[model samples]
Target: DAGVTQSPTHLIKTRGQHVTLRCSPISGHKSVSWYQQVLGQGPQFIFQYYEKEERGRGNFPDRFSARQFPNYSSELNVNALLLGDSALYLCASSTNSQGRYEQYFGPGTRLTVT
Candidate 1:
């Protein structure tokens, strides 16, 4: 089956513009999460959804938001973008069967705000 998929492998925007990134999880999986990775930094959790419910979120401003669909797909929406928002937006998916969960990441959507 297909792994995680994200759109617009890269992105560029100006300050204050809104951007929405999309993600589709692997087949038969029900957990998806969004993360932001800056230069030389690790991916920081933004939001996590499981079974169509919000499971967790990260230390981000109100400008960051996300949602998960019934088909296990997800979207990350950032509004009133700022310079600090420039980073690689990653989408991760995993199954809910094992005791430990390992995420499978997409290539990421690089958001650059100038």
Candidate 2:
């Protein structure tokens, strides 16, 4: 099976701008998660959705939002982007069965805010 995929491998934007990043989960996965990773730091959880419903969210500001489609794909939107928003946006697909959960991540979308 193919892994998760993210669009616009790289993106550049100016401060105060907005961006929308897309992600396609792996086949048969019903859960999707979004994360942000700054240089030299681990990925920080942003949001998670299961069966198209939001399950969890991290400490990000209101400028961050996301939605999962019926097809299991997800999109992350950031408003009023700041230079600190520059980082790798990651998408992960996972499965939860009998209390066991496994997640697989995509290559990630690199965003740069100038």
Candidate 3:
């Protein structure tokens, strides 16, 4: 099977603009997560959708949002972009069978807000 995959490997946006990043999970996975990684810092968890319902969220502002599809794919959307939003948007996939979840991450989409 394949690992998680992200689209538009790179992106650029401006302040006040909106952007969307896409993700596809590994086959048979039922959960997906979004993360943001800034330079010199660890990745910060953003959102997690299990079975198409939001299961978790981080301290991000309301400008950040995400959704999962019935096929297990997912999307991360950001509105009213700010320079601080520029970072590598990562997508991860996992499965929870016995209260344990392991995640596989994609390379990430690099978004630069100008």
Stretches > 4 Å off in candidate 2: none
User: Residues 67-110, candidate 1, lDDT per residue (tens digit)?
Assistant: 99999999999999999999999999998967887889998999
> Listing every candidate in turn, what is its Cα RMSD in Å to the true structure after a full C-alpha superposition?
0.8, 0.8, 1.0
**Model 3, span 3-27: residue lDDT tens:** 9999989999889999999999999
Task: Write down the lDDT of every candidate, Cα atoms only.
Answer: 0.93, 0.96, 0.95
Error (Å) of candidate 3 at residue 84 is 0.3
Candidate 1 colliding pairs: none
TM-score ranking from best candidate downward:
2, 1, 3
Model 3, stretches more than 4 Å misplaced? Answer: none
Candidate 3 C-alpha error for residue 77, in Å: 0.3
Per-residue lDDT for 11 in model 3? 95
Ranking by lDDT: 2, 3, 1
As for lDDT, the candidate ahead, 1 or 2, is 2
Winner by lDDT: 2
